[model samples]
Target chain A: MNASLFDILTIWLQRPNFIAFIILFLWGLYIMIAHHNLIKKLIGMYLVQTSVIFFFITVSAKAGATVPILLNGESVDPALYANPLPHVLMLTAIVVGVATLGVSLALVVAIYRQYGSLDEEVILKQLGE
Target chain B: MRHHLPVFVFLLPFGMAICMPLISLVRPKWCRGLTMLALAAMTGLSVMLYSHVIAQGPIRYALSGWMPPLGIEWIVDGLSGLLLPLLGSLALMGVWYAGPLVTEGKGSIHFHLLTLLLVSGLSGMVMAGDLFNIFVFLEVSALSSYALVGSAGGRALVSAFRYLILGTLGASLYLLGVGYFYAVTGTLNMTDLADRLPDLLASKAVMAGFIFMLIGLGIKMALVPLHGWLPDAYVDAPDSVSPLLAPLVTKVALYAVVRVMYWVVGGEEVGETLPILTLSSWLGAVAALVGAFLALSQQELKRMFAYAGISHVGIIVMGVCLGNPTGFAGGIFYLLTDAVMQAALFYIAGTAFYSLGIRTLADLGRLRGQMPWVIGVLIVIAISMIGIPPSGGFFGKWYIILGALEAGNYIVVGGVVGATLLTLGYFVTIFERIFVDSVSSGPAVLAESPLSMRATMGMLAAASLVLGLMSDPMIRLILDHAFPG
Candidate 1:
C-alpha cells in the first residue's frame, strides 16, 4: 500500500509508451497541417493514419506474446499470443488505405494535368481566382 | 421463412453486383437489364422484409452462423428494415434513369459499374451487424461514390476528389473508434458492444473513441460545420448520379450516425453521460434553418436542391437527437419519405436538363412550354417535398412533429414549423413558375421526357401519395414488429 520507490519507478516506465504515442500523433498532425502539396499531404495523411495503426498494434501486444495462431498444447498457448483482432482490422484498413491512395493519386494526376501543380494553393487560385 | 427476408434482401443485390461486371461483358446493354433486374429483385425482397418485420417482429440474422458477442449479426429492426426498401426503390429509379442518361462515350462503362457498386455498398451498410462490417461497406459506398461523382466532367472530378478525402477521414475516424471499442470490449458485434459499452464509458480511451466516432460520423452525415464537401459534391455530380447520391447515400450515413448514437452506444444511458444529445439536437436545428435559407439563395437547380437536402437532414437529425422512441420513428420516417420524394424531384429536374439544357433556375423559363409532363411531375414532387398533405412527405413530417410535441421539445416543434415554411419558400418559387404561371409565353407545347424516364418518375410520385394514405399501417409496422423486444 506504501508509495515505494520501486512502484513509482514501474509507473514511470509505463509512461514512456504513452508519451511515444502522443509524439507520433503530433508528428502526424504536423505533416497534415504544414504540407501544401497534395501528394505530400497525402503521404502525411497516410503517416498519421498508420500512426493510429501502430497504436493499435502496440496496445494489443502482450508482454512475451507469440503470434496469434494456435499450435500443439506443448508449444503454443492462448494467453501467449498477441490479440489478433486489431491486427486483422489494421490489415483490412491498410488495404483500404492503399485503395484510397490509388484513387487519390489518380485524382491528383488529373488535377495536375488541368491545374499544372499539385499544390493546393495553386490549384484553388487557378480554378477560382 | 419470413424471418429470413433480411438475409435475402442484402444477399440478392450484393450477389448481383458481384456478378454484374462479368455480365456487362456479354450484352453490354444487358448491364442496364441486369441492373434493373437486380434492383427489382431487391425491391421485392425489401417488401417481403417489410411485411415480415411488421408481422413477426424484428428479424435477426447471424452471419456465418455466429451469434452476437462472438460472431457478426445483422438485425433488421424497424429502423433499418424500412430503410432497406427505400434504398432499393431509389436505386431502382437511379438505374432506370441512368440507362438513358449516361453519356454514350467512355463514361458509360464506368457509370454502370459504379452504380452497381454503390448499390451493393448501400445495401451492405443497411444490413451490416458489426461496426467493422459497417465501416467496410461504408468505404465501399464512399469509393464508388467518388468514382460516380467524378464521372460527369473534369470539375466533377475535382469535387469528387475533395469528397474522397473528407469521406476517407470520416471512415478512418470511425475505424479508429471501433478499434478502441474492440480494445475495451473484445468484440465488434453491435449488440454485444452495446452490452459492453457501459463498463468502459468511464475510461479515457473510450471517451476518445466516442469523440472520434461522433465527429467522424457527423462529417459523413453533413452535420452543420462538417458539411463543406457536400454542396459541391452534390451540385457537381452528374445528373444521372445526383438522384441516388442526393437522397440515399447521405440518408444511409445519417442512419449510421443514429445507429452509433442510439443502439450501438445504448441511447439514453450513454446519451445522458455526454452532451451528444444536446449538442447534436442544437446543431440539427441550426443545420435545418441554415440549410433551408441557403437553399433559397442558390440559382442553380441541383445546387439549390442540395442545400434543401442539408436542411431536411437537420430535421431528421433533430428527431434522432430528441432521444425518444417516437422521435426516432419520426426521424426514420422522414428519411424514407425524403429519399423517395427527393429522388422523384431530381429525376424530373434531370429530365429537364436532358431535354432542354436548363441547368440553372433562370433558364427554367424557356423550359416551361417545352416539357409540361416533366414540369407537372416536378410540381407534384416539389409539393410533396414541401410536406403538403396527402404526400408521404406530409406523414413523415407529421410524425416527427408529434414526437417533438410529445417530448415537450417546443424548440424542435418550432424548428420543424419554421423549416416547413422555409421549405415552402424555396420550393413554391419553383412550383409557381412551372405550374401556376409559365415564365415564358402561353403554356409551351411540351414534349414529354422519354417513356422510361416518365415511368420511373411516375412510379416514385405514386409511391409518395400512396405511402401517405398507408401511413397509419406503416407506423404500426415500424413501431410494433420492426422494433419489438
Candidate 2:
C-alpha cells in the first residue's frame, strides 16, 4: 500500500499540466486577495476561471484518444474516443465566466465613476465616510 | 396541464421577464400588472403542486421528454413543494410592497424585469434536480440581485460590486466542487450522484468536494466569517430590493444546502464518516453569539436587521447540523417563519424611510403616535423576532431547543438561549424607543404609507401568529414527508 501511494504521488508530480493548473489557480487566488486595484482583481478572477477551464480540458483528454465524432459506417471503440461531456460542460462554464467578467467590469466602471478610484482602501475609506 | 406545473412555475416568470422590456416601451403600467399576474399564477400553481405532492409523492418532470442523467429534470418533492408556495407568496407580497417604490425609481421597468427574473431563478434553483442546473440558476439569481442592488446607484454601486466579486468567487468554488463530483461519479444528475457516492465516501476527492461546496455555500448563506458582503449588500440596496432579497436569497441558499446534504450526500456520511456536522454546529453557535452582539451595536435599522438575520441563519444551521428529523423539521420551520418576520420588518423600515425620510434609530423619535398601524405591526414583528410565544418564531426556536436537548447538545442549547436573550435585548430597546419614549424635537412629521403597503405588512405579521398556532401540524407534515425516516 505504501509503495502504491508513493507511486501515485510520483506520477502526479510528473503531470506538468496538472501542476501548472494548480499553480495558476493559487496565483489567481493570491492576486484576488493581495491586489487592491479593482480591474486587476477582475483579471485575477478571470485567471481563476481560466485555470478551472484548463483543469476540465485536462480531465477530458486521453493519451491515445481521437475526436469524439463518429464515422457514418464505422464501428468505433469507446476507449479510442475522448469524453465529450466535460468539454461541453466547460464550454457552458466559460460562457458563464465571461458573462461574470463583463458584469464585474461594468461594476468597476461604475465604481470608478462614483468614487474616482479603483483602490480597495480608498473605496473603503470613502464608504466609511 | 397539471403535469407541466413544474416548468410553468418558473417559465411563466421567465417568459414575462423576457417580454417586460418590450412591454414597458408600449405601456409601463402593463409591466407592473404583468409581474403581479405572473406571481399570482405561480402562487396558484405552486399550491396545486404542493397539494399534489402531499396526496401522492415527488413529481418529476423531464425537460424535452428526456429522462434523468440525460436531460434536465425538475423535482417537486415534499421539500420543494413546501418551499415553492412560500417563495411564490413572499414574492407576491414583495411586489405588492414595492409598487409605490418601483414607480418612484427611474428604472422602474428594469427593476420589475429583474424582480421577475430573480423569482424565476429562485424557483428554478428549488425545483432543479441536476447539480449543474442548480449552479446555473444560482448565478441567474445572484447576477440579477447584483444588478438590482446597483440600480439604487451611489453607495449601492460599491456594495453591489463587492457582492459581485465575492458571489462570483463563491459560485466558481461551487463549480469546482461540482467538477470534482463529476470526475468521480461521471454524472451530474443528483440522484445518480447519490447512488454513486456511497462507495466513494472515503475518497479524498469526495471529501474535498464536500468541503469546497460547504465553504462556497457558506459564503452565499452568509455564515459568520464569510458574511462580510451581506450587511453592506442588504443595507445599501434600494428599499424595494432589500425586502425582496432579505426574505429569499439566503433562504434559497439554505434550501440548496439542505437538498444537497439530505438528498445527494445522504445523512449517513454527514453523520458518521465526517465531523462536518459537528464543526458546523460549533461554527453556528459562535455565529449566533457574534451576530447578536454585532446587531446590538448597529444604530441603523436595516443594518441591525441584517446582522440579526445572520444570527437567525446561525440558529437554522445549528438545527440542521443536529442530523435528525426533529432538528431538520425545526430548521425548515425557522426558515419559513424567519422569512415572514424579516420581510415584514424590512417592509416597515422601507415604509418608515419613505414616510419619515430617515432610518436611524435616533431619528425615529416617537412617531408611533402618527403611524400607529406601522408601529403596531413593527412591535409584533419585533416580538416575533425575539421568539415570543404565539408567534411563528417561538415555535421554530422551541423545536430547535427540543431537538438540541434530544441530541444532548447542551452547548448548542445554551447558545440558542443566549442568542434569544440577545435578540430580546436589541429588539426591546427598539420597541421601547418606538412605543414608550416621548417624541423628541427631531423631525416628527409623519406621513402614512399607502394602503397596499400596510395591508401587505399586516398579512405577513398575521402569518407569524397563524403559523405559530399551526406549527404542530406543519412540523408533522415536514417530518412525515419532508424528512421521512
Per-candidate TM-score against the hidden true structure: 0.92, 0.97
> lDDT for each of the candidates?
0.79, 0.87
Docking quality level of the chain pair in candidate 2: medium
For each candidate in turn, the interface RMSD (Å) is 1.5, 1.0
Top candidate when judged by lDDT against the true structure: 2
Model 1 TM-score on a 0 to 1 scale: 0.92
Deviating ranges (above 4 Å) for candidate 1 = A1-34, A74-77, B1-8, B104-106, B432-443, B483-485
Tens-digit lDDT track for model 1 on B143-178? 889888877666787788779877877887787788
Q: In model 2, where do residues sit more than 4 Å from their true spots? A: A1-9, B104-106, B436-439, B442-446
